[model samples]
Target: MQIEPMATATEPTRKIVQRDPARTRARILKAAIAEFSAKGYSGARTVQIATRAKSNIRMLYHYFGGKDALYVRVLEEVLLRLRAAELQLDFESMEPTDGILKMFDFIDTHFGARPELRRLLAFENMNQARHLNRSAVIRDAASPVLGHIANLLRRGEQAGVFRPGIDALHLYTAMVSLAYYSRAHAPTLSRIFGTDLLCHQWQADHHAQSHQMLLGFLSRPTTA
Candidate 1:
């Protein structure tokens, strides 16, 4: 004797909307990189980034908190990307010379191909590292790469292929300096030398020279 009520005529049907937070966050991050790189941290606007991302500013704030926080996230992201790429080097398992050569080639290839990375690094330096200092994530991200370099140097020294007394971090810095400087100063260097270092042949030449220089540096005997 129980009666069940059917749908009422005046009742409204409910519709559900699904939101993809990961995709939205990625879009925001991508847009933020372009805006931050082009304008530097201070000049980049959340609204502009949102517009570029085809998102709204509220979502940006909701996702990242604020401009400084977003910049920190961008730095964290860029550093993480660099760390990830660096981690792909199997230098630790290879012969020392081969490892060094591979490391150099990898650096050159990465920098030459990824201009956005260069721009983001340039922006970071432009701010005197204000935003980078805000992120512990970046520092942690750098640790493994640095450790890899140290291990490589130690192995090279042990195997008698590389000289002792060279600090791993220092050598790593040297390698980065040599690799990064080319792309970082390409415009001016190209203008000054009247040659496009960005071109394949030129970069190939530079890459060979870099490998030679690093090998020579590693080959020198340690003083007693």
Candidate 2:
């Protein structure tokens, strides 16, 4: 599931007049995300990442230790972005269904905007998640969000708007799978179906279907 680099033409070389360590490091991390997403851990090159960042290989190593370290950072950053966004939603204060739908829409919009994340995840999974498993930061990122979802579900059940006995992890997994599977498999599915799954219309239709499916499932009443 490796993606072709979004841009392969190297930027024109420019002389360094001033240095901003924070900005420079951020630039390198951004470049690393693109490189790893495009080529995966094994295929990605340090030189390509350096060139994309307009920095040198030495700085990349300096900031991130090495290719493996940089790849781990990329994994952390992408997952952190999603988790942070989820945390920012005052879903606790909002009505249960509204909060859940808002969460769904956020995930949908985030994936649509950053297909690189889908690519990066696919790349890591292909690697047996050897790199991702090493990062404690990444491992612990989901707890709060899962707890938040559980609380949201509790509220919904109390209000009789959502079914009881839902597992937060299960719900979260369902939400992600519904949102992710289509985009991740778009190309292969497109070829099989003889249609452009990446097209705006196709994505929009799938989004609507996913939203309906999840909402309907959650809103169903629990049987006695």
Residue 136, model 2, lDDT: 96
Q: What are the models' TM-scores?
A: 0.88, 0.89
lDDT by residue (151-211, candidate 2, tens digit) is: 8899999999998788988988888887888899998999999999889998899888988
Question: Residue 144 deviation, candidate 2, in Å?
Answer: 1.1
Query: What would the C-alpha RMSD of candidate 2 be, to one decimal place?
Result: 12.9
lDDT of 1 by residue, 1-224 (tens): 89888866876768887889999999999999889878888788999999999989999999999889998888787768768988987775698778777777777777777777788889888779887887888887888887887788888888888888888778778888887888889899999999997888887888888888998899957669
Candidate 2 Cα outliers beyond 4 Å, as residue runs: 1-16, 222-224
Ten contiguous residues minimizing lDDT sum, candidate 2: 214-223
Model 1 segments more than 4 A misplaced: 1-16, 222-224
The model with the greatest lDDT is: 2
In model 1, state the lDDT of residue 207: 81
- Cα error, candidate 1, residue 175 (Å): 1.2
Assess each prediction's global lDDT (C-alpha) against the native.
Answer: 0.84, 0.90
